[model samples]
Target: MFRTPLAAALLFATPAAAQQLTPAEITRVDAIVADALASTQVPSASIAIVRDGRIVYARAYGDQGPGMKATSADAKYQIASISKQFTAAALLLLEDEGKLSLDDKVSKWVPDITGADRITVRQLLSHTAGIQDYWPQDYDFAAMEKPVTPQQILDRWAKKPLDFEPGTAWQYSNTGYVVAGMIIEKASGMKLLDYLQKKILKPLGMQAMDQDYAVGPGFPQGTHRFALGPVRPAKPAAHGWLWAAGELAMSAGDLAKWDIARIDRKILSPEDWAAQETEVKLADGSGTRYGLGVSLGQHDGTPMVEHGGEAVGFLSENVVLPEKRFAVVALVNADFGGAPGEITQGITEIFYPPMTTQPAQTIDQARDALARKLFDQLRSGTLDRALLTEDANYYFTPQASADYRDSLAPLGEPVRFAALGKPRLRGGFVNRNYEIVYQGKRLVAITYAEPGAAGKFEQFLVQPR
Candidate 1:
């Protein structure tokens, strides 16, 4: 929960402009995904780019898994949290039909819920209900393995006190969506998945959006490389528990189709569509970066509506530049190290390159390499004088090195290192920051370096974030 902020910051960097992609720029989108697959060693991925309510680019690359050949353009991959957008849409549609109202008290439908009388349907949609997240990453796995029904989920979670008073703060809560899913069933008299198929999926001709693995042709296999390692084959989302929270699987192409139709307002009225895109306000009327199920923000000066998802063995991202009528949807089969947003940003840069270019690629490479080397030495309780200037080396002397060792000893071993953002030339030196997570500690390694033959560490600091 805490770690995602860094990645989100990197993905939403402001660009100078936004425009339509030319034919050559569209080709570069494919190249970006291809390079990502080759460099990261990701098994397979499906990518689709849409423009002006049309599918401009949709292709799959690499193998589906160990034995399968390259994935097909239509091969389904779990869309993860992107499913939330549709769930939110369905609820809004119900409101349009006079079946329910966003201002209606949730207790009206689920009376026994602890704070249902105080929370509104709009609060749940916007994650301001203060409901605790149901499947926190650290939750016990044994409980998740056992199937659960919506009523069982409500009985288990709805009676607890909210994390805070409704509309007071914003915290992403999968449980809120799970509760929303139940409300859809109670108000509409249809299963959440079946209602979506009849109301949204079939209407859009999105055949690839399967509710669960047991039905349809099933999802392409996915593998997790960290923690749990290789998981069992991917399947449809279970009926209960994760149902409305995150349980839809579809191809990148199909996901793109949904986004295209959304821009065209094909399923819902214009007012309802606008509500889905509007950011929710807290008790003080401060805007949350999130709106309903989708996030609302600007990328490179261009307003954007987007969402990303990560499940057992899949990672997906969907970005829509509504003003430009451009969207990019990427679905990957591997977990742990995939960068769907980075791939999406690379595509965005092609269509809307940054206004001012920065340092040469070589400078960034040098900074990253030197930063890694310094941190490696620091973790080992030593400092490499050769990598620093005489004045810089004096700052991290032997005594200081010993102190660093003593202070950081309890943090345990370093487990992961990742760039926080691109290296940039600032004050005549290249500045960069990297996230280094220890077994129990997380820190940002801030570094400054001078490039060329005399390039060496000008400044270095590593401490708790």
Candidate 2:
């Protein structure tokens, strides 16, 4: 899904050498979002960055489409399995209270489930329990009716089959998390949502969050969709079944607060936070991979903790780098395309840039002036595609180029880019072309065909180039 890797890469030298990122670093951060906004058809998105127990950046962009195309520092996104860390944290809080044991079997909490008699609480949090994800569409819908309750999920789904004998292997299973959420409920004698709101959300100052799925009324943005294609009335996930898999929403503002709170140990004990950071090993023990719901990896040389979310029309990622004292969160409203967790990781490299950089335009004044003039004409469509036509010398990264072609394939068309001369476009959506030109060391124009409207050749490029 990574069409192109960023030119900006972070070289983690040492924790002691780390400090807040610079202005240049911030430019890279915004550029990553800009590229995604143009390439992906996302209508709206929110991003937040927190560092050293502080919210350094919290921003939003794009229109809400049917609503207002606006960015909100207070906009809340339904962060899917990225919710697992909190789910695990909730369970651990109970463990600290002596109400449950990390090693306790699921049978103790939900005694009705026969298959879960041996799945331990820690195994559920670590996703080591052999359980199947219920939402995969392969299940017979005729037999499955209506939304399920917390206990119903354990009894109906958890009893299906283990992905492996307990702790023998690892397969991401939403079923394990449902069990963890149940443990929280039974141990606390509070509904999972109520307990989380009281202990986690409120304490962290995250007031605008909710996992509630249409309780007695309709929502302004519609209930969460289970799928995002050309499908009708996108399937809304069963409320209780969501459990710890997904269903939490919070504004970028609130998330920034929560990120700082984690650093402060405001909601979780130090020992529990340490355990959450412990690297979870793979089944065959080849790699110490996942920890609770988070992925542990390296960028340059810095250790990273991060997770992504997917629910109906929403796609998102939240990342944390304790060593760097930095974190980034991105949430998109539409979720048809691939939105990998690494996207945020990639953006982070730019937000907190390293010394050794890769770019054509450095910190220069003249280049910036030229770039602005060139982009202004191109964006306004006053210039034509003739100035920046495709050249044999210029080739995109192979994957990015291929993706462009694939997307165009739906329209069964080829776009001809900027051409030479006065910049007139030719052909239709099915067959079109353009050209890009640099006139005598000056930026010129780019002209491409307009698919639907024929005989109307748009020409925007008109510069000294």
Candidate 3:
């Protein structure tokens, strides 16, 4: 019933500060991947787990052949929808330059766009715009012998009716991001790739990444060569056809660096970064809970901003947990499997294994190796328990810049618990708490948190009655 989907490495979102992981600790995730590959049907996959800023685990199995050996973490991948973040980022950067606003009309850039003027940039970024996806409704899935020019693509859907009235609801429209890419091209007077490289890639030190699809004609996105992998056995894919949506190729090494950026607030400014975290309101006039290019969610109850991708013969993902200071990049050479998400989810499970009485440091160590020594001291019963004594009055997490605990109950607390001087039952992880307890040899924990209205729950460990 459970299907689907962070760590030490980078995020374009900015790298966060935390601890690192040792190679032995990193391999724990690797031990389980044989099963992940068999179940997901992925030919070959590479996964990286970064805790704080260091990559704790990375490995590859299977063939991602590009006239060579099996694909490894260093292989280049066409990360499908994940490219939307890049398209979205270019727009945000332009907005920062005052090139346009999220509320700006598309007609401002795509003259003669018919109803383009009716759509706002905000709608485009979040796929709330009413635009029809450009890939023909009966699009030739197997091949596009002829490349569709930007104008040609817009034309196919020119007379096509929108899925709905602008901003009337929420729909996953690739056309929205396609339009966004076009606007970036129109407004910047540069090819999608050139502009991205100059503005985003080069600045972010993404030297190994490129926006080319080996298929399709028209537009020379780039020629930066890297290893490519085959899906099954025949016909290799060119990167051009992916166009603006998912054409970029990068090594896991470089991708790791970018994930770090997401945590560190390096490439984008603090305000712009914060803007990326704002959730988009759904068509129902309720929030759909996604940030600009980021999706606001969680990995083991920690705040995560991430996105997934699947296009043609490969799948890719980038998941980052800001509060936890880690990110993950999982890429697979498979067109139809769910390896990316599965691989990521497995890695998360290992890194932040469900809380047990095994000791709090075990969880902390899963996230940051740098914390292991300190936690060891605590575990060895060597460190003065006095630290917890003096700090008992304060919540363990470093004081938030603002109160994240406002009026909320804590998680895992009621074997019988209290909060803010009130007798309360914390229903979920939204603000749950956990107190270490010894429960016989099993040492299992009782949980109070669930993913909730706010999308995150505070994991709590409460003392049993």
Can you write out model 1's per-residue Cα lDDT over 1-465, one digit (the tens) per residue? 011222322332222113345768756765687666544445667788888777777766655653333346777777777899889999999999999998999999877777999999999889888776655441123355567876787777666777788998887777888889989999999988889999998888887544346233334566543221122344323445467887688878788878888778778888988999988889898888889899998877788999988776677999998788888888877553445876887887777776754443332555566687787677667677888754457557565566566655556667877777666443234567777787655666666666563588766666443
Evaluated at residue 237, the lDDT of candidate 2 is 50
In Å, residue 155's CA in model 2 sits off its true spot by 3.7
Error of 1 at 203 (Å): 0.8
Sort the candidates on TM-score, descending order: 1, 2, 3
Question: Which 10 residues in a row give candidate 1 its minimum summed lDDT?
Answer: 1-10
Worst 10 residues of 3 by lDDT: 220-229
Candidate 3's TM-score: 0.65
List TM-score per model, in order: 0.71, 0.66, 0.65
Steric overlap count per candidate: 4, 45, 56
lDDT of 2 by residue, 7-103 (tens): 1111110111123558776666666665564344344456777777677666665543333322344555667667888888888888889999888
Which candidate tops TM-score? 1
Give all candidates' CA lDDT scores.
0.70, 0.55, 0.53
As for model 3, its CA RMSD to the true structure in angstroms is: 18.4
Error of 3 at 449 (Å): 36
Please give the distance, in angstroms, between residue 242's alpha carbon in candidate 1 and its true position after superposition: 2.0
Residue 209's C-alpha lDDT in candidate 2? Answer: 46
